[model samples]
Target chain A: MALPPYAGPLETTWYYGFRFLCACIFIFLITPILVIIPLSFNVEPYFTFTEGMLAFDPDSYSLRWYRDFVNNTQWRHSVENSFIIAISSTILATFLGTMAALGLSKSHMPYRSLMMGLLISPMIVPLIISAAGMYFFYSNIGLDQTYLGIILAHTALGTPFVVITVTATLVGFDHSLTRASANLGASPTVTFFKVIMPLILPGVISGALFAFVTSFDEVVVVLFLAGFEQRTIPRQMWSGIREQISPTILAVATILVMFSVVLLAALELLRRRNNRLRGIV
Target chain B: MANEIIGGDVVLAADGTPLKASLNKAMRKNRIRALLLVTPLFLFIVFSFLIPIVEMTFRSVDNWQVGTLMPKTTTALAGWDGKALPDEPVFAALIQDLQAGAKAREIGKVGTRLNYEKSGLRGMITRSGKKSLKVKEGPYKEKILKMHKKWKDLETWTVIKRNTAPYTMGYYLNAVDMKYDKSGEIVMRDENRRIYGKLFLRTFAISMAITLICVMLAYPIAYLLATLPLRYSNLLMIFVLLPFWTSLLVRTTAWIVMLQSQGVLNDLFVFFGLVSDDNRLQLIYNLTGTIVAMTHILLPFMVLPLYSVMKTISPSYMCAALSLGANPMVAFIRVYMPQTLSGIVAGSILVFILSIGYYITPALVGGTDGTLISNQIAYHMQKSLNWGLAGALGALLLSSVLALYLIYNKIVGVDNMRFG
Candidate 1:
């Protein structure tokens, strides 16, 4: 329903130019990030220069940095910690968030709008304060600096994402299916497990995946609560970037972009199979 | 009768079952389902989140240490003033309080901590503490000077005794940039150093500007996507989602890299022969760059909502108007644009709310010029160790967001919110 400005050559040229500018800008904006993907393969220490230029030979690309990164202890530990936090936070956030979404969506509730906002405020609340509060409060609970501390903190932060995604999925759900199951002499628990769970399970799984990514990528809060030994990948990357503008970080970023793409693709595949899962369940 | 017969319940056909038992069972099932569904969230709120926040809010007001000990002294001092230096009995009580406050290390700590709550309190506490330091001998005025020279001013002494009051307007008042007098009246600080209110205003203005810019850029693109064929529309959609899948750090870093002096953007312009070599194109380290990059990042946020709403609108409304002899532009303006108003409102409010709270965008691109209220909140928490001020700023942000959200919910209806 967009109105074209005019048929005049000047106006049309301007519109065409502006649209082209937008497309070019979008491509230009993404180049810095995509540049790293190719640069990762470069046989060079420097970011801007290649080794072949100095050697007077044909330029080459290889997996030297990838090999170094795989063997590095710091990188290995950071990846391990990221995995541990992501898995734990995803489980806890998904469980709580899915339940909350289902409950809030019911016909009768006092101030569901208010409740939803309050529940999701953790997402909106400047996380530094939450991180600060956790620093002090967790110290007393004897969870600070341990894996449990980071896990709980990440779960707290990630649950809102799960709740939002699952809640949105609930909007399109057919409520009568649950009623039909109950009317068919199934117990409420059996109905939930057998009928309702299957219908919304895509949402739940997607929510969990989102929560996993949220926890994995979070840095500022981790900066507050995470001990050096237990630091996440993002936290490690922050230190790396801040301390040294190393080429290794570019390698790391490229690797991470690949990892996230794979995870997202897996989630998409699950979403596509949602109908099959629903039928089986 | 015929319609009812066709749509009749399968379980019964003899003039339909009364089904009271079945209806009640269904109701009970729903209630159980609702409870079962909500329990996980309630438990999370109670344990993981609510408890910690409650603890912090409690600590914010609490004279916890003083509440525990010398309860009477804290109570009496709350009623006293620091005018014209205290008489001997206050000095005697003061001596006892200082010794107890030191031995317990609570009194001076709170005041010192309160100083962190407001910047001016640093000098105020030091002046007050030195003035109020107990004289062990007679001739207390000289002893006060001997302990600390600034204690001679009755005004300086007033600040000391006022701060020393165990239960006082010290922390909370300071949070809002107000301070208490000897008479315990709250007053604004001197005009030259007024900073808090200015920062608050600047924060809101920057957020609003960014929101407006994002909407302007996104609306035309969103309109194009909604009206275009599925092939091109889907291709554009893919581009929008690509940014979402990437790392926030990577996106932010890319902006830094592009906007840097020696980066690709400047190189491109120079290569095209548009700008001279060594052209100083100031992009990053300013408010403009913050707006540009943040708008880029947030543009898709505006587009998705608008596009979804536009997709549902039938083109026939505009077609009908055009056939009725309304000009094409007039028909589109009158019919098509109004249909997308909800999307506009939703996108605007969403972008505004998100942009206002954004910390990293401004920090990376805005540099000194781009720092917003959240940046100060972060500064207070990380550097100053003043949780009170940080908490106060945070609470203010929450209230503003909540108020706007309530308005948005009322006007637009949160129930219809998509793209969650």
Candidate 2:
């Protein structure tokens, strides 16, 4: 707010003080993320600023950790596994969740609330419990420690984001357009593709991204369900941090921070596109 | 077009079919179609998610291992009174069952299961199983007592008899720091062995502390974002959303870098003469580290809901209060604060629930004293190989979280939940 000239010193001080407080909070939020980027580049294997780094000497920086992260076979395997599990689960979750969202949005759907609760519960329930339960059940069924088990477990965890996001997109959907297409002798499948798909595609994509991230970032369930061969990035990082303190983790963390930035940008764009499609912008 | 009245109450369409019947048929078709669309996912979740948790809950009270292993002994022991141990028939049945159990190599499972109740019984059962195979005659009580001194104790028999029943509350009792004592009475565990009750209380206390810190830290920024012009607020929103979007492990890793004993924070403090380098503060792998990292991770949860609520609040109300002669602090507290109660409650409960069940961040940073109940549950599940106790602890944690979730759903509709 613009300050009025008639404001007293107390008001001015409180306003500036409050703004400063907020600025500090924002700094607190961003500093940890920002601090790692430079630390990840430090030539020394320390997390703090060395004298050379503070002096802005070019010798203070190196890509050793980044190179180590890329060259390590374990890290490479984890990255591959992360993408494999994330992509497969996201696809499965998106398909199942999109259909469920469509049904849930229909006014004629019976017991929609109850169905929604059950579908979204995986997101709400504690991950450890879900993992523990899955560990027992999947082992009994001979699926535990298998790739398929981890993928299916992740899909179950990821589906709620798909349902929530897709249902949100469907909220502003115009039903008459689909009805009009049906009335023109088009079959339900054809109308869904030509009319409904184009409008909700952004929502579906963003929902898929959400599901992808959920699977990508999840480690607890993976810890329970994954074999050593199926270790993902977070799982790898978890053990690395516990077993050894190294800048390689920071380098990886920096890379993940950048990846999230890209995902965040994509989500923002999708949101804008969604709002424009719904005529809210 | 003909609008025909067929029966006294029936209205017919131009096709001569009753309109009410047509409407009902169309509605039923839509309902079926909707249900069909949902059925695949509904069944998938039930099979993959719901059933597993139900099975886990059942495992908490499931005590069939002993009964299955020693069926003959269980039935024979059922008839004997608890006074001064069982008669010779009970001992005879026990020897018979132990010999068979040893031959099947399943006595180990029974021993392991019973070990959760009385620690030393595992050795006794295994020893008795080995010794019982040598005995070929009746008068087995003297032989069994001679095999192991533990067999002479009445408490051992009491525990064995209590577990022979297919379902028992023993696991749940152990979960809450209570177990059956020597006289077969439920009592709190000895002071040195009690862990879960204290862990539960600590989890609650830590979660509440984190929630309060989040609210305090998030309020000013949420207010600033809510009050600023759209352009500024939109830019400032990134500071919140970036952290919200970052991996939980990444944020936790950042905190470790910043808060560890030879880390940047300590280095800076040492450089600034705040403390000598020889005695750096022990900040991480403890409660302070857990609180600091969790507050950072959970701050966005508080900010998002508060900002959403604050965005709906009009600025004119504050201006009106200011013009009405009430001081700004009083006006903000009395007039503006009440409007944000729903956001405050929703955010607090959401953070509290999330914090209570938190595993990754705390597991990484929370050393023995700072660890929550979930970590203990994981310990039992993995390290201790005590699935029954893990299930019991998980069931308790799940119920409390679900209860809070239901309350959150009541206050703030779950559909309104949004994430960046």
Candidate 3:
């Protein structure tokens, strides 16, 4: 907000001071993330900028770390594993969560709040406890260290986002359209495909993206449940941070930052689309 | 009109059933259909998520090793007093139990369980199990006692006798750094062995610190976001959302890159002549690193709720206070701050709960002194293979979080919770 012309010097100083404080906080929020993008390209294997880099010498920058990340079999395999696990879990979580959300949004659904709580407990409960619990139970069932176990665990973890997002979309939903479709002699299945699906598609897709990110970024469960063959990107990054501090990790981090940017843009688009569908924008 | 005809205070459908009854039947059908749709995920969560946590919690007291593995010995010890070593019949039962346990190759679990209560019992049990197999005749007491001097100690029998029940508080006791003394009275562990108590306190302290710091940093930014024009605010919002959207490991790695001794922060400090170049400040892998990294990571959580709440607060409240002969700072504090208390509470509790349960950031950056309780739980699970202790620690941490979560639900309402 701009200051009024009648403002005193003290108020003007406070306004500028507040803006300065906010700018500092914003820098604190973003600098750590932004600083690594350039550091990742350092020709020298250092976390800080060299004199040459600060001076803008072209020799100070290189794609060596990115090349290393691409050439490493472990990193490549982890990327593959991350996608396989994240995608499979996202599909399962979205399906189960969407159906459950539809039911939850219905007024006649029994124990609706209780059921919602139970469904979303995965997100609320601490990741370590969930991981520990699953570790023991999966071991008992001979599922630990398997792709199925990791996928199942992540699916359980991801469903809450889908449920929440889809349920949110359903909150502003008009029931008359579905009833009108039925009155027009459309079957329930056909009405769902023609009406309900198009309406909630944005919510479902955004929820799926959320689930994908949740599973993709998850490492605690993977640490407990995954063996070497099932190491995800975060799992590899965990060890990479713990065991070896290297520029390759910076490259990987930069790539992940870009990936999240894409995901964020997609989610924002879905949100805008949802608002438009609801005629709020 | 025939579909619902009013007749003598009751309406009739075309099929002649009362309209009210038909409507009730339809509602019941719809309810059942809704329940059916929810059942698959409900059952899936119950089996996969809820049941596993319940089972893990049960392990904290699931003392089956001594009761099951040494069943004969447990039965024999039933009649004996813990005042002294057992009699001849007890030794005979012990020999039989040991022979069975060793032959089945399941006695090590018993050893491991007992080792948690009292040291040396694991080796004693395993050694006696093997030595008992060689005993073919009577006078087994002398043979067992000779096999291990621990057998002669009254505390050994006491430990075993205490664990003979199907369930014991031994793991929970150990989890809190308390144990039964030789005389069977519960007492705090020795000074050097006591860890979990301090770790629990430190976890709370660190979480509280992070929560307070996040609120402090988040308030001004969130306030700025709430008051700014939509376009600028949305642009500024990315600063918060980018980190929120980024992978957790990526942020942590970025923190490590920035906070390490020779990392970006130190280099900047050195360039500014803040300190001598020879001795860079130790920042990462310590308490500073954890607090800094976690605050940055959890800051967005604080900002979003506060921003949403602040956006709803009309600025006229502060203006009215200003018009009523109040100074700008005083008016802002009295009028504006009180309105945002709900947001402050919601964000504080959210950040606190998250930081309390935080593991990875602390593990990667928190060297020996800075780690939280979750890292300890992981250690017990992975390295020590002490599942019972891990379960106990997890249960304690989970209970606190659930209690806080209930409070959060009461205040913020989980249904209203949204992620960026």
lDDT of 2 by residue, A115-184 (tens): 8999999998999999999999999999988889999999999999989988988988999999899889
Poorest lDDT segment (10 consecutive residues) of candidate 1 chain B: B1-10
Docking verdict class for candidate 3: high
Model 2 pairs in collision: none
For each model, chain A TM-score? 0.87, 0.98, 0.99
Q: Against the hidden reference, what TM-scores do the models get?
A: 0.84, 0.98, 0.98
lDDT of 3 by residue, B310-338 (tens): 99999888878978999988988888999
Which CAPRI level is candidate 2?
A: high
Compared with the true structure, what per-residue lDDT tens digits does model 2 show for residues B19-73?
8777788899999999999988999999999999999989999999889999988
lDDT of 1 by residue, A1-102 (tens): 233655678757766876776676456435656766765666776454354633545466667778777888998899999999989989989988988898
Displacement of residue A22 (Cα, Å) in model 1 is 4.7
Off by over 4 Å in 1: A1-25, A39-68, A108-111, A183-185, A267-281, B1-33, B57-82, B103-108, B114-142, B160-192, B273-279, B412-415
What are the per-residue Cα lDDT tens digits for candidate 3 across A1-281?
Answer: 88899889998998999999999999999999999999999999888889999999999999999999999999999999999999999999999999999999889998898899999999989999999999999999999999999999999999999999999889888999999999999999999999999999998998999999999999999999999999999999999988887899999999999998998899898889988988889
How many pairs of residues collide in each model?
1, 0, 0
Q: How does each model score on lDDT?
A: 0.69, 0.92, 0.93
Interface quality of candidate 3 as DockQ = 0.87
Off by over 4 Å in 2: B1-9
lDDT of 1 by residue, B209-269 (tens): 8788777777777777788787788667656666666677766666665676655566667
